[model samples]
Target: MIELGKYAGTVLAAYGVSLALLAGLVWQSIVANARARRDLERQEKNG
Candidate 1:
């Protein structure tokens, strides 16, 4: 890895935070999709 010298800790922390946020967004999307699909199926069955 390239040397980040004196700012390595700060840079790494920023990267970690960004990756975590991205993961959370992806997880939220998946959960939302599943819920919507289930609701749609329920509605169809009821109808």
Candidate 2:
């Protein structure tokens, strides 16, 4: 395919940073959702 000669390093670094940020966001969202669901279930059970 595609050539990546002079700009290879910059492109790779940008992609790596973006991937890391996206992964972090996904993990945080999952944890928040799980916590919220557990809290709701607990309230329902107690009430």
Candidate 3:
């Protein structure tokens, strides 16, 4: 593993928060994309 010295806690916390935010962003993007695809399919079928 990597050592972070005296600032390890602060550094690790920052990384944890960043990782969580990124994960949430990715999840939202996937959901939104899927919804858009479904809407497009419905419109195409009705048109």
The numbered model that scores best in lDDT is: 1
**Evaluated with TM-score, which candidate comes out highest?**
1
Residue 28 CA displacement from its true place in model 1, Å: 0.3
Q: lDDT of candidate 2 vs native?
A: 0.97
> In candidate 1, which residue ranges exceed 4 Å CA deviation?
none
- How many clashing residue pairs, candidate 2? 0
Question: What C-alpha lDDT do the candidate models reach, one value each?
Answer: 1.00, 0.97, 0.99
Model 1 deviation from native, Cα RMSD in Å: 0.5
Candidate 2 has what TM-score?
0.88
**What local lDDT does model 2 show for residue 3?**
85
**For candidate 2, lDDT tens digit of each residue in 1-47?**
57899999999899999999999999999999999999999999999
- lDDT, residue 29, model 2: 100
Off by over 4 Å in 2: none
Which candidate, 2 or 3, would have the higher lDDT against the true structure? 3
lDDT by residue (tens digit), candidate 1, 1-47: 99999999999999999999999999999999999999999999999
